[model samples]
Target: MLDFYTNPMSRGQTVRWMLEEVGADYQERLMNWGPSMKGTDYKKINPMGKVPAIVHEGRVVTECAAICAYLADAFPDAKLAPPPAARHDYYRWLFFAAGPLEQAVTAKSFGWTPTKEQSGVAGFGTYDLVVETMEGLLLSRAYVCGDAFTAADVYFGAQVLWGTRFGSLPSLHAFTDYAERLKGRPAYQKAKARDDALIAEGQAST
Candidate 1:
């Protein structure tokens, strides 16, 4: 059985959506912030002391992007990944979203912009460039990996969804439309509802 360790409000939501997409049965071990997540016991699962780690078939997978990719490969019946022979764009944009795009978004959230000189080594170049590149990709196709939704979309779509909603990324038309399309997915809706309810329950008790 798949064992998922997460917090409702954390990036764990991304994995939850992927799990739902792949139709995998998982036992969620919700870990709150601070001690619950940082303690020695959980540390063995993820030394970084973060949420959204998974133990599947006795193998531990952390990092949202890796987990998404692993799930797609693990449960091939979901067709969440393109066949290995046709993964040019699939692998390309998946890493694009996980690496440069992710770095750019985090830089934006931290209110940091690398100078022109700094951009050379910053990896993401500039946030505007990263944003524009992503926008151009989505404007050309229905999904990141082209015509069909793949596990890559779960990670990429989550970026657009949370980034646009929280102001980390600009609300451009391409991003707006892309986020809407992802929101309509049953897996996305189901996973979101579960997290939303958890958030509400926590608030009520407080």
Candidate 2:
């Protein structure tokens, strides 16, 4: 069985949704933000002391995007990944969401808006460009790679969903419509319900 280490309030929720998407039978090891996550035990699983790490068949995987890609590939029956010819867009948008998009959201949250000069040096260019680029991509297709929903959608959709919720990304029609379509997925609903319950349980324990 897969051992999933996570904290509901963290990026772990994204991995949880992916697990459900792939129909993986896994055990969840919920870690707390401070003591549980910072301890040596959890640290060994993810040296960064982050949640959303997974140990599957004795192999360890960390990072939300990596986990999503790994799970999709590991379970070929799920057909979450596209053919080699289509992999360019799949990998492209997945990392785009993980890298530039994440950076822009983090910078905005910390009120660290980058100047044009700084954007030139930054990997994401400018925050406006990041948002506009993402919007244009989604505007052109139902999914990142076109009409088909692949593992890339799991990562990109989660980013867009979180960005829209926290007001980091604009509530553009393209973003909102895509996010709504993602939410309609049964796996997403299941993951959300499970994580919501876990969050409530954690709060109660505190």
Candidate 3:
């Protein structure tokens, strides 16, 4: 069985969305910040003492990108990842989001844009370059791997949605339009409602 360890306000929300998308039967173990997440017991699940860790069939998976990819492959019936033979764009965009896209937006969050010389050494080049590149790709296609939605959307789209909402990313038409499409999905709504309720419950208790 799949055992998911996460906090509602964390990146785990994306994994939860993937879980719903796959229609997997999993047990959720909610955790809080500080000692609840950093204690020895939880550390065994993730040495980093982080949320968004999963154990399936006794194999542990951490990191949002890896977890999303693993779930897609583990439940092949979900069709979240394209078949091995047809995954050039799938793999490309997935890792691209995990690496350059993440770095670019994070750097922007801190108000750091690499200069021309510095950009050569920065993994994401520049935030504008990353943003323009992604905007171009979305304009050319419906989803990361093209017309059909995939697990790539869960990870990458979450970044776009969160980034746009929190001002880390510009409210470009491509991003807002794509986020609206993802928000309309039944699985996305179910996962979001669960996390939203969790957040509200924690707030009420505090």
| Cα-based lDDT for every prediction | 0.95, 0.93, 0.94
Better of 1 and 2 by lDDT: 1
Q: Which predicted model would earn the best lDDT? A: 1
Q: Write down the TM-score for model 1.
A: 0.98
Q: Which pairs of residues have clashing backbones in candidate 2?
A: none
Per-residue lDDT over 1-206 for candidate 1, one digit per residue giving the tens place of the 0 to 100 score: 99999999899999999999999999989999989899999999999999899999999999999999999999999999999999999899989989999999889888899999999998899999999999899899999987899999999999999999999899999999999999999999999999999999999999
lDDT of 1 at 82: 97
User: In model 2, where do residues sit more than 4 Å from their true spots?
Assistant: none
Ranking by lDDT: 1, 3, 2
Clashes of each: 0, 0, 0
Name the regions of candidate 3 deviating beyond 4 angstroms: none
Off by over 4 Å in 1: none
User: Predictions ranked by TM-score, top down?
Assistant: 1, 3, 2
For 153-193, candidate 2 gives per-residue lDDT tens digits of 99999999988898989999999999999999999999999
